[model samples]
Target: MTELHRIAIDTMSGDNGLSAAIPAALLFLKEYNDTALILVGDESKILDELRKHNQEPNERIKVQHASEVVLMNESPALALRGKKDSSMRVAINLVKDESADAAVSAGNTGALMATGRFVLRTLKGIDRPAICAPIPAASGHTYVLDLGANIDSTSEHLYQFAIMGSELATAIDGVEKPRVGLLNIGSEDMKGNEQVKAAHKQLQDGGFNYIGFVEGNDIFHGEVDVIVCDGFVGNVALKTSEGLAKMLSQEIKAGYTKSIFTKIAALVSYPVLKSFRQRFDHRRYNGASFLGLKGIVIKSHGGADDVAFANAIGIARKAVIEKVPDKIEEQLQKHLVD
Candidate 1:
């Protein structure tokens, strides 16, 4: 029998709360036979939602009661210091105590990061943990790091993000010597500020497959395996890309429904349009891994629905199976010792 991997879900933390998480858990359980879930939230509410779908606690599904729910706008400090029994904190506690292999939450990004760092702590040789997630690319997808965990990062932190991003691509995507790049204003060596330039120098000699510098456009080129930047820039780029994708999708639909002629044209192009939609659906890439943590934690979008939340759970499952934290630690130790 395959070893069972358990994931703790903060069922009370997302925008849709139990509605999204409960259904997502059921969907995920149906797909992964060797996995179990520890749903962390109000026991009564969770059971009620499960029963709505005609589900009851079983050997594979367990419930852990958490009295509080972390609000989406809750301050990180408050959530960290005050909401000790919040679903988000409880879910992360499961990881720290080794009760669960990983934790998945669609809560406040700041709170999740703050609580995760406090609870599991960063791995040895890592000063901070970075949020890493996949962005759709031309060839397939590219993983970017520091997606809002540490808004202000130093050159050393950027270098650390590169190492962690590279290892993640290797472990999760099965890439060998993943090409890593420093996000800069220009592809030239002297285009960015002090931080980017300093990071570029460090990466050149850092021994990984450093690809010099990559601009914002490079994120969609699929040529670079990993792009590393501070949390501020990465977050802006991610949000901009999301906005652009949404605008383009809306424009496409509006254009297709403008007139009877266009409506007929849309029918003719339905297959191609569907393929495009499926290829670029943001829901397919819902999970962002908290890299450099002692344990695995995935952050889903707060507004994620069942499909998207289920994708987050799948990400946690993959991270557990690949031993992502161990791989990152091993690489960090090798680099630090060298």
Candidate 2:
């Protein structure tokens, strides 16, 4: 039998309450044979929600009580200073203390990022840690880093992100020599803002398969593997992509429901449409890994539903099994593509 990983998950802070995370946890546990979950939250609330699903947070899943709750409006430092007993704090401590292999949370993102760096700390040689989210592309998915973690990211910071993201693509996603690209305004090699232009020049000279600059439109085209950019630019790109996806989806829904004939046609194309919708779904990339941290810290969408929260826990388990952080350190030392 394979070894089961102990994953700590925060249940109190997502847009959805224990209602969503608990059920999703139950669903994932059913599929994963070699994994145990430690849920950190109001124990009674978690247990009560579990009972709602005719289950309990028992041995396969354990509960740790957290009294303080971190609100979304709280500042990163303020939340960290006072809410020591918050679910996010308890979850991070599990990995920091060797109690769990990784930690997953759907809480105040700012607090999670702050507490993760403070408690678990960054890996050696990594000036700043980054968040890697799988962006929708043609064939499968490509990863983008620093998606709002460090808004004022420097050029050296982006280079570090490239190293981190490439290793992840190869190790976890099985993408070898992941074609890297510098996110920019134009496809031409010598275009865009100074930071992007400089980063492009540096990557072009680097050891990886640096594939020049990729425009904003190429994100969904499946053209690149790892996207390199400062947090300010990367965050804008991510939000724009997400917003466009949502708007398109809503428009499609309206068109389909506009009339009885359209609804009938929609039923005929429902399966194909469903697949298309799932194709660009952000929920599929619900958890964003805080790469370069000593232990795994996955940040889920604060507004994530139950399905999203459960998927976040699943990501943490995968990181533990794949030995992501250790692999990141190993790959950072050497620039091998494979």
Candidate 3:
């Protein structure tokens, strides 16, 4: 039998709260034979939702009570200290205590990062954690890092991101020597600011598969397996891509049903259109990993629904099975931490 992955889920702070999370958990359990869930939240509410879905708290589906819920707009520092028993914190605690292989949350990004850092802490020799997620590309997918985990980072931080991202690409994406790209405006030698330029030098000599500097266009080309940048730039690129995908999807649907003749044509081309849509669907790419932490933690979009959240759980499962955190530590030790 395949080994079961125990995933702790913070089920109270997402857009639909327990309604979406409970259903997502059920979906994950049904689809992934070797996965179980610990639904962390108010026991009573969680049980009610489980019953609504005709599920009971069995061995595969367990409920761990966490009386409080973190607000979406709550201050991260305050929530980290004041809401010790919050669902998000409790979920992370499951990983710290070795009760769960990984933790998944669709909570406030800042609060989740703060609470996770506090509970799980960073891996030794790592300065800070980075939010890394897979972005769909033409040839394949590219893993981008620092997706709003830190606003300002130094050159050394970017170097560490490369090491961690390289391991992530290898462990999860199955790339042998993942090509690392430093995000910049121009691919020329002296194109970016001082920080990026400094990082470029380090990556060139650091002994990884450094692919020199990559522009934003390189992200979709899938020319590089891993893209490294500070959180500020990474966040902007991530959100911009998401918005563009949404706009393109809407435009395609709108153009297809414009008239009777167009609708008929759309019917004929429906299969191809669907294939294209599925290729760029952001829901399939819902989970982001908080890399550099001692324990595996996945951050789902706060507004994620059942299907999106289920994908998040899948991300956590993959991270656990791949032993992503341990791999990052191994890489850090192999290539001296900056």
- Whose TM-score is greatest here? 1
TM-score-better candidate, 1 vs 3: 1
Worst 10 residues of 1 by lDDT: 187-196
Error of 2 at 338 (Å): 16
Residue 178, model 2: Cα distance from true site in angstroms: 1.0
Candidate 3 lDDT tens digits, 161-223: 999999888888789999999999998897899999999999999999999999998999988
Over 167-210, each residue of candidate 1 has an lDDT whose tens digit, in order, gives: 88987889999999899999877689898899998899889899
- Better candidate by TM-score, 1 or 2: 1
At residue 96, candidate 1 shows an lDDT of: 94
lDDT of 2 by residue, 50-153 (tens): 88888876668888899877888789999899999998899899999999898888887788999999999999889898888888788788789888888777
* Model 1 whole-model lDDT (C-alpha atoms): 0.94
Can you give the lDDT of residue 236 in candidate 2? 90
Clashing residue pairs in candidate 3 are: none
After superposition, candidate 3 runs with Cα above 4 Å error: 1-3
Q: Rank candidates by lDDT, best first.
A: 1, 3, 2
